[model samples]
Target: MEILKGIVLLLLVLVGFTMFSLKMPKGMKAMGALAGAATASFLVEAFHFYVGGDLFGITILRDLGAASGGMGGVAAATLVALALGSSPVYAVLIGCAVSGFGILPGFFAGYVLGFILPKMEEKIPDGIDLIAVIVIAAPLARLVAIGADPLVNATLINIGKIITQATAQSPTIMAIILGGVITVVATAPLSSMALTAMLGLTGLPMAIGALSVMGSSFMNAVFFHKIFKDKSTTIAVAVEPLTQADLISANPIPVYCTNFVGGAIAGLIVTHFGLINNAAGTATPIAGLMVMYGFNSPLKVTIAAALCAVAGLTIGFIGSLVFKNFKIKSVAEVRGTV
Candidate 1:
């Protein structure tokens, strides 16, 4: 029952993000900005602070990670505002104002103020507009962040808790569910990194997310190579699916279905090995693999990773064979270059 609830909740969140990207004004750009913010903050913190500081005894790197990790709100606000066409000065100002807020809150604040700042500038006189922005926009951005904090906690955080609990109770089931879902999300605009970070996932669940995604790198590479037969497109998808989001989004069935199968197999391997990742939001490919060494034995981590990669490659090959006859959009077609 808990497993079902967790799956439902995660799906709803993913669906909500998809709807936002499809329907909201400038939503895809906003999500991209959010992913960038997660990379700047959570990824750095996870790799440097948790792995470098905690495991490797690198004090400077640890400190750098700590600083970056705590600045999620600032990063999200600044980036999102910039993505939404806010001026650099106003974006940074609004971002700095929401210093202590979480990423989602900062995102909301930046998104709202991104639109409002322009209107204010137009309505108010030029010289006075700066003052008006300082007085109104800054405080208002903070206020929006404050308002969003509770909702984020109630939804994303609670969902994380439920997943954690479900993992504790039924590791195998949760492994398949989380592994597949998170991998699919990695290919989507929602971004597995942002999702795991927002949910504050750690321990085994985080491990599943990180390694499963890392495994997906191989899966995507093989699948894209076979399907597209384009060296550049295959390399791009292997390196980072988001870079070729247009291509992937245009051909979702094969890509997403392959990712789910590969991710599920990787998750089972992770469960069998009892590997763990303490770093939250390290649901990336290279970095995710690197962070696993911090929490588990080096040899064990290496072995598990190798197995996951094999699983991913096998699935990718099979998926390609299965979908070989399916119609697919080329890079030129998807990008409108043709």
Candidate 2:
């Protein structure tokens, strides 16, 4: 049940945001805000140990983490408000005011309110519009935040439990599914590290995730090499694919399908060998392989990582042969330079 909730939320963010952004200017800005928010959250999460400290049992760092999360919602709301023709000051103020609830809730509230406020903006007289927005939209958004709080908390708990249980009960199947999912998320604008951390994925599960991401990169490098013949671009994509979002987005069908195949293979291998990664930032090739070395023999881990790459390459090659629909655009078509 918890897993279902998590999957639903993931789909909402991925599909909902994508559909909206492609259709509206405000939606694009909202996505940008979300990306920015994810970055902020990732930084805070990645360095919590040094920046967050316990003094007098105050839990300052923890609060900072929460506040950072809220700021992401604030940023998203502010961008959407701006796109809705609200004044900069008004948008920022309302965003901060409503986002006090928390990140996920604040985002949904702001998104709902942002969407509504624009329609009403044209009806109100200019002099009173700002005040009306503040009075009406702010509280309504907060209400949404208040309403979603329980569901969000419950979803998080269920997601965590679902991941824990799946990894424990059916490691192989979970590896295939979770690996594909994690790789997909990692390649997107959002941070897989943050997602993994939020889901409390550690040990063997973490290893599976890390290797899966790397495997996707491996597949990408091969597919890209065949397309562009640029070793540099292939290497860059292997490290982190989002750097080439324009290119990757153009061929998402092939990229993702190949990634799923590669990642599932990697997941199977790592889980079968009982490999693990107990550290962050392992969701890439070098870092992920290094994480394995932290717990296992260097030679063994190196070989395993190599095999993971091979799996990705093999699957990717097969996908290229089978999927004739993969449309590769010339570098100029993507309109972005790598």
lDDT (CA) per prediction: 0.91, 0.65
Runs in model 1 deviating more than 4 A are none
lDDT of 1: 0.91
The Cα error of candidate 1 at residue 39, in Å, is 0.5
Number of clashes found in candidate 1: 0
Query: Over the stretch 140-243, how does candidate 2's per-residue lDDT look in tens digits?
Result: 87787788767766764356556756677777767777778778766665556545644445677778887777777778777777765677778888777767
Per-residue alpha-carbon lDDT of candidate 1 for residues 225-319, written as tens digits (9 for 90 to 100): 99989899899888888888888889999999999989998999999999888777899999999889989999999999999899989999999
lDDT of 1 at 338: 79
Alpha-carbon deviation at 297 in model 2, angstroms:
11
TM-score (C-alpha, index-matched) for candidate 2: 0.66
